[model samples]
Target: MAHPKEVAGFKLGKLLIEGKTKQVFDLPEETGHCILINKDRITAGDGVKAHDMEGKAAISNQTNAKVFEILKAAGIPTAFVKIASPVAFISKKCDMVPIEWVTRRLATGSFLKRNPGVPEGYRFTPPKQETFFKDDANHDPQWSEEQIVSAKFTFNGLVIGQDEVDYMRNVTILVFEILEKAWGLRDCALIDMKIEFGVDADGKILLADVIDSDSWRLWPSGDKRLMVDKQVYRNLSTVTAADLDTVKRNFAWVKDQLDHLRPKVHHKVVIIMGSAADVEHCQKIGKAAKKFGLDVDMRVTSAHKATEETLHIMKQYEDTHGALVFIAVAGRSNGLGPVLSGNTSYPVINCPPPSSNLVQDIWSSLSLPSGLGCATVIYPDSAAVMAAQIIGVQDYIVWARIRFNQLEMAASLRVADKKVRNLSIE
Candidate 1:
């Protein structure tokens, strides 16, 4: 149901191909971009049952646009460009990957079928990742990493391998985790979701395809009775007009909630160094904090030499702001962390400048008087991470940043472990 203007924007060249859910159009003027027209039709069980609810194309377009927009903002690599119309959007032209990457938080659906004896609501700690061959004729059988690596599949002129599979899994989990935290603030649990990837002309695999209400089972407050996703449509005994309308309403509700789900950017992190000598150390923390989307302010003030000035600085920061954490940087006989911790109600972390007597410097921070709680860190980045965690307790974006950091480390370990195991072959 594309509007005349929308069709005019995409149909200038030729219709590339049409799938069950969308139509791919080739754009001769743009070498690396194409237009994707989302269809209103939806199906479950590998197209066994199908329905074409009215106005679904626009609803799905809205949802996919919001999902892709947020993913791009979160620094996730994707193939989304911009929404072209109410039912269409422009995206990077890529050879689509024939695999579906799935991530799950709860043991339900097909998971229980495969792993019997597992409880329905049993949670996955880091979320379970799975891959399946996208074969509608064969019911999309699950595939292991070994199978994916060994199978012969080429996308965007790049062949699949162990590294490719590993990267896809990593990106899939990242997308899930970031969006999961986003939804968590809306009092919804992202039970499970799947996404497809595509290799661009430059051979970089990116998150692609549509992610709307059809992508995941979103249980509000972790209750299945309040589920709002394609599952609601799947659960219907027999599709009818009323049931289709209910599904349409649920999809709209899910799309409407996305606008308010992202965490607010009001939280701020301030780093105060006692002297100019510690400015370098404070900057390191501030830089790393900014990488994780933390709004950081660096200031130099001494709690011992300029106690009044330091208090003024803290007071100025908290004059109107409430969600803020402080990191104090002072070297020997550190009084900055203690003074800030004692005076302020906000969290204060000690990231003292390095010294020859390192143990003593750390002890100065660790050994605080009763009721004074200023956390200590040896390195600058860790100090930033600690402060993020403290603020993340209440800020969802900060929490997601910390989670992405963990995933980055996990990714490194995974690659290293694979290399270590294949040392004999090398």
Candidate 2:
């Protein structure tokens, strides 16, 4: 099919590719971007069964835009640029990876069909991942990680080696888990999701393709009967006008719920040092805390020497709005954490400055009196992580940053493991 010459004022150069539900067109003037236009058509069983649901294009574009916005804010790299129109969006042009990465939190649908005898709704801890080669005629057959690395398929001059495969696998799980937690906040369970990747002109691999109603299985209120995803459309035995409308309504509900998913809550972390000597240690905690967008305020006050001044500092933060976390940095009979924890209605973390007698220093912070609920961490980074976890309970943005860091750590471990494996004598 010939592509449109112009769409939403952006001139379409050529028809790049077409899928069952979307079409990609190269931008004539934009060298590195393309326009992806969603179609009203929906399909199942590898396009053997299909329907043209009204208003689906606009609904899908809206959902995809919102989902990608959240993901990009979470620091996940994606090809999505911005929404171009009601039915289309702008994206980075890339040589697409011919693989679909699927992560599952619960066993159902094709998973149960492929692995017979496995009961439906069997939960998978850490989530199970499967890779499928992108071949529609072949029903997107499952491919193992070993097979993926062995294939060594190159896209945009970048080879898909074991390292790359490991990175993608880790990222696929992160994307699913992050979105899963986001949905969980809205009382919806993200059962499973399939995502694709692509290599850009600069040879950087990124999450690509559209992620809307058709990409995942979402069960509202943890009940499969109340699913509000493309599965509802696929489950229909016989298509009818009213059935399509019901499916459309389900899709619209998902889009509506997403509007409330991105949190607007403010979070702050106050790092209080017992003496000027602990300023360096407290600053380290503040540095790490700022990475997750938590407002960090460093102060100098001795809980033992100036009790009134210390209590005055606590009163200020207690009066501030939003979620707050306090980090107490002190050594030699540390009392800041206990004092702040006892006085204020906020979480307090104890991170003592390193000294010659490390064990003795830790004891001061660790061995706290009963009823004082202050937690202790040895490293500054650990203290920051604990603070982020506390703040993330109310802030989705911070929650995403925490998850993103976890993904990076997991990827690094995989690379280290691969290095050790290669060093072994053959």
Candidate 3:
């Protein structure tokens, strides 16, 4: 196979690295970017076995690009830029980390071999995680958190310490869970998967490497017999021409399934207020909702004065055939939440604006009538988060954004604490 010097009009400068099934080349025109070209090759057992399947590169690139698209949309930082061609993609140039972070939802494959007594389908409550040092000659032995921290490796001027390890581990588990929920929506089970991370020139750690059928053990409808992943190729002891053809078909099918993983229903948040005067408060909620990928629609109608109009608005949204949560932002004598909650099956939340009689306004929202299960939040942003959570039950992209936000919050606190402790020494 010959490596092309130019791809998508970008001149490939030099081969940066070559892996079992891909090659990384520096882009001469793009200082911070590179091109990753997938090969038609697949390997397992640390390259003890290898095979070349026609068109596997294209299939792998398609799956990887789609997976990265979901991750980037959900607020996870990654190295993927865009698909350059059928078998190649553009990416941020990063110093690759020599660790393979694996997350498992079911006890199978290597886990079963490592732990003899564990049954084949044993489930993990929180999905187990493990790290392996990438040493093909040594079979990539598993490393403990302590081992990773003690190694103190450096990548792009950043040290791999306790803090870095923690970040990578949390993100690894998050990546797995996000994709697991996505595949679950398609009635597929993500048994387990491995991922790698890298540090770019800016020293920011991003979710790097490729994720495709080669990266996971996927089973359709939770049945192992219907598994469609690289495992099928790995399990073949004596590969004949006919066996390779079957493996190619499975890869193609996996790529096809990813095309339908995105949600068909557009979940939304509807903010209904008693008066147009509350538009500012509703706008605040709308802004926060959009941050988490929730579509927001604001309307003004009074449950006390324009009762029929308010119910009509609720019915119109319910008939749209999409999941929606209603946020009532009425201040005085708050009855909008109760009316909307009682009329529709969708979740309702009351966010009362601050007024002269703030105490009474809050009490009115808290003290709801019987069978009216509407929740109340004082801050507008909190109401948006609650609505996102309610809709995120079935929306993987929204759920991932919310989860990633939580991680960012925790990281901010850690940074703040470190600064405070340093201040005392100064």
What local distance difference test score does each model get? Answer: 0.85, 0.90, 0.91
Put down candidate 3 lDDT per residue, 1-426, tens digits, no spaces.
Answer: 677889878799999998999999999789899999999998889889998888999999999999999899899999999999999999999998899999999999989999999999999989999999999999999999999999988988989887788889989999999999889878999999999999999989999989998899999999999888889888898999898899899889988888888877667799998888889999999999999999899999999999999999999999885789999988878889999989999999999887889887788899988999999998989998999898888788898999999988887787687678778553
Q: Tens digit of lDDT per residue, candidate 1, span 35-133? A: 888888888888888998889999999999998878876667789999988888988988888899999999999999999999999999989999999
The model with the greater TM-score, 1 or 3, is 3
**What are the runs in model 1 whose C-alpha is more than 4 Å off?**
1-14, 115-119, 276-280, 354-367, 409-426
Q: What are the per-residue Cα lDDT tens digits for candidate 2 across 289-311?
A: 88887889999999889999999
- Candidate 3 weakest ten by summed lDDT: 417-426
Model 3 regions more than 4 Å off: none
Question: What TM-score would every model get versus the actual structure?
Answer: 0.86, 0.87, 0.96
Q: Between candidates 1 and 3, which one is better according to lDDT?
A: 3
Error of 1 at 142 (Å): 1.7
Q: Between the candidate structures 2 and 3, which one is better when assessed by TM-score? A: 3
The worst-scoring run of ten residues by lDDT in candidate 1 lies at 3-12
